[model samples]
Target: MAHYRECPAYDVFAPNCPARLVLERLADKWVLLLIDRLSAGERVRFNQLRRDMAGVSQKVLSQTLKRLERDGLVERQVYPTVPPTVEYALTELGATLGGTVERLAQWAESNMPAILLARQLYDQCGE
Candidate 1:
């Protein structure tokens, strides 16, 4: 007799599915921005990331980075120095998402005008 292993299928739409938790993280605006910014494949300092993201508070950035680190999508390295220099970069798993994240960013930029027009039409219709 031969035995085979079974792989479980996950559906994000299901509340109890672990994939839903991942989807929640990926759907966060800050998480998306951080992933896109780090997609450049360079290790960036916390302050640099803050400046690049503009409008994100330091506290929020710290929290988001911690979450990303916990998720295994980002790697944080701390160098022993005066104040302890810290840098963040995407992990191999995170790098796999870079292209997809970059494409999503491009799509948003490319469709902004159309999106604005649609929003204006919707507001005018007052539906």
Candidate 2:
């Protein structure tokens, strides 16, 4: 069995590191939205994802789904039918990530009121 070599600290932070690619992909707007939606365990059609995501374009959504599938975070299923049908669902890895994203979302939601109040106060104080 071949053991994977541990990356040096410098290599880990290099721009070309594979870790950076994962971070960039996960931080994208469409990926974030899709992951959030899929956290509910409901398999969604492409059109349904577009509708639920609000501002995403068809092209962008298609790209995001493809990337997610490639990363093993999402599973794409094609139904056998005359007209053709496709659905997307999160894989186990995706589900684990969904929990982390959910926590971040919850924190943002919980603190939004405070953040708004601070913003109002700052505006009134001219700072």
Candidate 3:
């Protein structure tokens, strides 16, 4: 079977669409948070990440970091020390995503009141 590549905007269901793959990554709940955390371009240790990302289990963080690293968005460095320290940092590509996510976080912070009011109105209407 042959598929069309001429029009991506019209191929919402196309299995090979590049946009879909990127969207899948961006839609993950932790991607934005991880990106935001690494936005400062500072190397953060594994324990530090766990501390900052409250409620994220060690397993989940490991999996998410693996995925991000595979996608060229994050870098993992292992240093030989007394305990063999491990660090995670964002790559250049991830910083681009970080800027966008930062703006989204800011928007969420600024609009929470209005959003809550809208939600209250919606709940009242349903009742």
Candidate 4:
């Protein structure tokens, strides 16, 4: 037996929409990087993630992980060991977003040159 409530329609453009809160979280650069990293479909150690995402401070990574976990986009697992082991992985919901984030990252990388040129032109003549 399954009981499902009808989900409400979300209008992200509405200032008062609850979806705005989620969009706000997803807009964060750290959050985007974390999501893009974990999209690989493997649980990664905290230290490994920190190493891979350069420029992320230890504190910021920790806080971002906590926030993602709270939002149901990440799963945190702990294994009892000498020093204890912790890893992060994407939840099913998060997995659904993986491809989208990956595409966004790729788009940024591929279009950066054009964007830079556009900015330069704007600065030089579009005043």
Mark the 10 consecutive residues where model 2 has the least summed lDDT: 1-10
Flag clash pairs in model 2. Answer: none
RMSD of each: 5.0, 4.2, 3.0, 4.6
Model 1 is weakest, by summed lDDT over 10 consecutive residues, at: 1-10
State each model's CA lDDT, in order.
0.90, 0.87, 0.88, 0.91
| 6-124 per-residue lDDT for model 1 (tens digits) | 21467656555677678889998899999999999899999999999999999999999999999999999999999999999999999998999999989999999999999999999
| TM-score result, candidate 2 | 0.79
Tens-digit lDDT track of model 2 for 64-100: 9999999999999999987779999999899889988
Number of the top lDDT candidate: 4
The predicted structure with the larger lDDT, 2 or 3, is 3
Candidate No. with top TM-score: 1
Task: Rank the models by lDDT, top first.
Answer: 4, 1, 3, 2
The clash numbers for all candidates, in the given order, read 0, 0, 0, 0
Using TM-score, rank the candidates from best to worst.
1, 4, 3, 2
Candidate 1 TM-score over all chains jointly: 0.92
Badly placed stretches (over 4 Å) of model 4 are: 1-8
Q: Give the Cα RMSD of candidate 2.
A: 4.2
